[model samples]
Target: MKALLLAGGLGTRLRPLTENLPKPMAPVGNRPWLEHLLLHLKREGIDEFVIAVKHYPEIIQNHLGDGSRFGVQIEYAIEQSLLGTAGAIKNAESLLSDRFLVVNADIIHEVSILPLVEYHIQHKGLVTIGLTEVEDPSHYGVVQQTDNGEIVRFVEKPKQDEAPSRRINAGIYVMEKEALQWIPKNKAVSIEKETFPLLIEKNVGVFGKIINGYWMDMGTNERYRKVHWDLLDRKCSFPLKEKEQGNGIWVGKDVQIGSGVLFLPPVLIGDQVHIGERSVIGPYAVIGDGCTIGKHVRCSETILWDDCKVHDSAQLSNCIFGYDLELGASHILYQAVMNRTAGVLQG
Candidate 1:
């Protein structure tokens, strides 16, 4: 089945890291975040995709470039202006001529798409939204569904005391072509704030299904770091290309570890990485491709993107380094996110 990926948001919550790059282009492990999502969906039998893009669309277009390298066919729908969730889909209506999967690019998951499609077909609903349970429904749009999977209503961030259910919109939807009729043209519209509620009020066929899978919204800096930890811990079933050393160390090719360097397990070192002598790395550290670390450097719970350099005696804990950035010698970095921009450094 074809999938419509909504990837147009400004990535406000993940700023600095995404200031120069689009969120979809941000590095996740050794690959771009969008590439990871695309490959995962490809495994689920989706070979055709319509990627709705807006903010920094050129970066995404340049990276994916028709998706042939990833064994998928991609069609880009570039929105000239900011469009809300539903409006983005509306912008790509021409490409979706049948029942297609709609996904918000902010989420990464291993949801079984076929099962959700099947569920949508069995109920004969115009749209079936995937729902997942979270501890706090106060921050998300909660859905009320009947015992038989029919969606009754939606509550946008209800107070904890009045929350109808813990299940919130999973940002995955299976929509029929006919459902496009309800969304008006040439305007911004939110799927949660306007479209779905309108469908319910009009007595249209809208349903919800509780889905089981590993799901995370990597929309914030905290959540972005957490996704790495979750993946490294094997909490999800998504495929990774790293070689596991059976001692909690996963490394890519040509990774060099200097003598006397101490490592705590659950450490991931990417291609062409160098760890200098006497450096203590990880318990939860990810060294991105082409990174160089000097002697006696200490890194704990740190994630560095490609080509970053840490000079001698540097200490990094709970820090995120963006592409091609460098830390001077003897620098002590903690709980900070740094990204390079226009040949300058930002922290």
Candidate 2:
């Protein structure tokens, strides 16, 4: 099956991080966040892809070029202007098969696609939206489905008290070609707001398939940190490059650890990392490749991306450092989130 990946949003919620990189390009573990999605879909037996991109298309193009590295075939459909959800798919309509999968690129999920496709085939629906339950459905596109699995309507971000159901749209869908014609050409359209409503109005078959595993939208600071912790906690099936170094610690090559350094379990220090004596790290610390931790440093519940350098006596807790940022000596911080750029958030 051909899957259409919507990779072109402005990603304003992620702010400075998305200033230089696309939201889908955000790092999950050692690999790009979007790589997890592609590999997950590929594992479910979907190897063909149509990536619709608008912002920083080249980064995504250069990274996942031809999809050969991931054992898949990929085609690019670049949109000149901002096209909303449905419009992006409409823009790539020619590249898609008669029936295809449409997935939001910023999402991280492990829902099986083959089962959703099989459900769509059995129901014979023009569209089948993957739904997942959440405590607060008000912020998401709420879905109401009949007992027979037919989706009745879509209420986009309704008030919590007025919501019809807790099953919200998971941004994965099985859509048919017939649904594309309903969306106008060269115009911004939202699949949840416009296309699905119109498809329902026409009395066409629209269904819902409940997802059974992990799902998250990598769109904010907290969510970004959560994904990394989730990856470390073994919540998802993403592969890691580092090897286990015993005592709940994972390390990469050429790691230099000074004596008297205390590791508190569940820590991952990447390649070429240097930790000075008397430094305490972890119980949920992720030090990226080439990072330098000086003496008397304390780091926990933090994810430092590649090349971040922390000077002597620095303490970082509940923090995330972007690439190549520095924490001066004797500095202490908690709950600081720095974007993956020059913008440093310090105490």
Candidate 3:
């Protein structure tokens, strides 16, 4: 089956981090966020993907490169201008099969697509939206459905008092190609605001599948960090490497740990990482590939991307150090995301 990955959002919420990098490219577990989504779909027996992209499309193309290395065929539908959710799918219409799965790029989820697809096929619905109950429905696209799973209404970001149901759109769907005809071509259109409402008004079949699994829309810095922390804390059952050594720390190949160093659990030390003597790392830290840490440096709840260097006596807590960043001696950071080019580096 083919899947259309809606990756066209400009990511206005995740600023600075999304300045050069697209939101879908945000790092989670030492890999691009979209990579996780793609691999997850790949494991579910979907091989072909059509990625609808607009902002920073080249970066995705450069990294994924036809998706051959990942054992999938990738095709991109680049929108020259901004198109809303439904419009982006409309832009990629020709590439989609008669029926295809659509998923949002920013979500970190573990719901199985096979069951959703099977249900859609059996019912022959125009659209089957994957729904998950959220504690707060005011910020999401809420849906009202019958007890039998037929969707009756969709409220996009309803007020607290006006919300009809806690089941919100999980940003995953099984959509028939015929549904694309309802969306106008070359225009910004929201499926929630335009197409789905029209479908219901026209008496088209639209259903909801209340999927039971981990789901989080990592659209904010807090939620983004929370996704990583949740995975590290074992709050979700997403596939990730397990600890092979002391204290639930997942260390990579050729990692060097100096004497007298301290490491807390749930830390992931990437390939070829070097830590100096008496350094303290982790309690939810991710040291990316080829990083070098100086003596007595401390890192907790931090993420150091590939090839970064930290000088002696440096301390970091609740921070993210981007690729190739260099930390001067005695530098300290708390609750900030820093990259080498962002000018937050302390000399």
Cα-based RMSD of candidate 1: 1.6
What TM-score does each of the candidates earn?
0.96, 0.95, 0.95
Worst 10 residues of 3 by lDDT: 238-247
Which runs in model 3 stand beyond 4 Å of their true positions?
A: 241-243
Error of 1 at 53 (Å): 0.6
Residue 178 accuracy (lDDT) in model 3: 89
| Superposition error at 227 for model 2 (Å) | 2.0
Per residue, candidate 3 scores C-alpha lDDT tens digits across 1-347 of 79999888888787766777778988787778889889988988999999998989999999999999999999999999998999999999999999999999888888789889998988888999998998889988899888878888888889988899999888999999988888999999988878888998877799999887789988877787788888777787556543457656777888889999998887888888899999998888888888999999989988887889888999988987777888878867878776657643665
Per the 3 Å backbone cut-off, how many clashing residue pairs does candidate 3 have?
Answer: 0
What is the TM-score of candidate 3?
0.95
Give per-residue CA lDDT, model 2, range 1-347, as digits (tens): 79999999988887776777788987777667788789888988889999999999999999999999899999999998987999999999999999999999999888878888999999887999999998998888898888998888888898999999999889999999988989988899988889898999897898998988889887888988888788778887687778887856889999999999999988888999999999999888999899999999999999888888898899888987778888877777777767556644344
Off by over 4 Å in 1: 342-347
Ranking by lDDT: 1, 2, 3
